[model samples]
Target: MRRFIDSEADFIFVLAANVASIQAEQDAIGFDAPDAKYPHKNAEGLCSFAVLVQEKFSDNPILMKMARIVQAADFKDQLDDHPAARGLQLISGGFPIVTSNDHETAERAGFLYDALYASIKDNVGL
Candidate 1:
């Protein structure tokens, strides 16, 4: 997945979104509707992923920042800490854009993930 993202391969973003969404759901255990898709159920695992990314990509400062974003987006409720949390919640829940087809949903959201990655990549200097 990392390679795909780096190489600008096709379908990488949507694939990532789908994979992340599914893993978050399966790894998730207990939570009420609307909140279930978020990482509230297993925050330890989510944070652990960030740690793993940090350890693996210690040289890539941008990836490390992404790790922090993932952690905060999944765990932090204070929007100031993780402004993307609300958007992640909505997208994961398939709110306004989700359709009956998972593939289609991923395909549509692929662009969004691509934009997000681009934003992260562009802000690497910051």
Candidate 2:
């Protein structure tokens, strides 16, 4: 999990929650990635997309909430202690996150995504 600085919001909480969800899946089943890949390799594009979505749904409280959650959960410390990370460690038997696909375990990835978006929106006052 990547960490973001420059804010003290609840982004860590949201990230932890999402990570937890994903780790659950990995524990139940398994992950298959031949080579290491950057999950958010296109972060710039993703950020741009997030901005567009926020702009389009500026009046939607639900969207706002999601952004705020994400923003608040973006801290580095949170990523280090995230439940998902722990879960992955247990399931993978000590594999590094870069080689793991534990984040796919979330049953409700959509909900988690929504919450993250809301958290980010709230933090940026968008």
Candidate 3:
């Protein structure tokens, strides 16, 4: 957060458990909640970051697949909605996020996400 004090990102992502206050303050959305402008689900019944991104650019195949994957992974109880979700969770579980190294864990996971995105983009089928 302190890093953003000097430099602000074009899109502020608040993927937290409790996003009520943040939504009110920043007019942002969350992993599962919606604000005044954004809805929790889209017309296609997509939720999470999926709906948000889709609203802007729905023509891309890669983004749509990523959104589907994200929608499944966002729900803790329905992690099995997508086979990759459990694998991703397990892989991330191996990280040092528990030791308060969230930034480090996220940094390590960045490449993994990039790889996944690339895989999705390269493949024609979901």
Candidates 1 and 3 compared: the better one by lDDT is 3
Number of colliding residue pairs in each model: 0, 27, 0
**Ranked candidates, highest lDDT first:** 3, 1, 2
Q: Residue by residue across 14-77, what tens digits does model 3's lDDT show?
A: 5544466676787554344544344565555666457655666588787777777767775667
Model 2 score (lDDT)? 0.37
Candidate 3 runs further than 4 Å off = 1-18, 26-46, 94-101
TM-score of 1: 0.47
List the candidates' TM-scores in order. 0.47, 0.28, 0.57
Q: Which residue pairs of candidate 3 clash? A: none
Residue 65 error for model 1, in Å?
Answer: 1.8
The C-alpha lDDT values of all candidates are 0.53, 0.37, 0.62
Residues 23-45, model 1: lDDT tens digits? 46556322212233332334455
lDDT (0-100) at residue 100 of candidate 2?
Answer: 39
Position 103, candidate 2: lDDT: 42
For residue 38, what is the lDDT in candidate 3?
46
What RMSD, rounded to one decimal, does every model reach? 8.0, 14.1, 5.8
Best-first order by TM-score: 3, 1, 2
The TM-score between candidate 3 and the true structure equals: 0.57
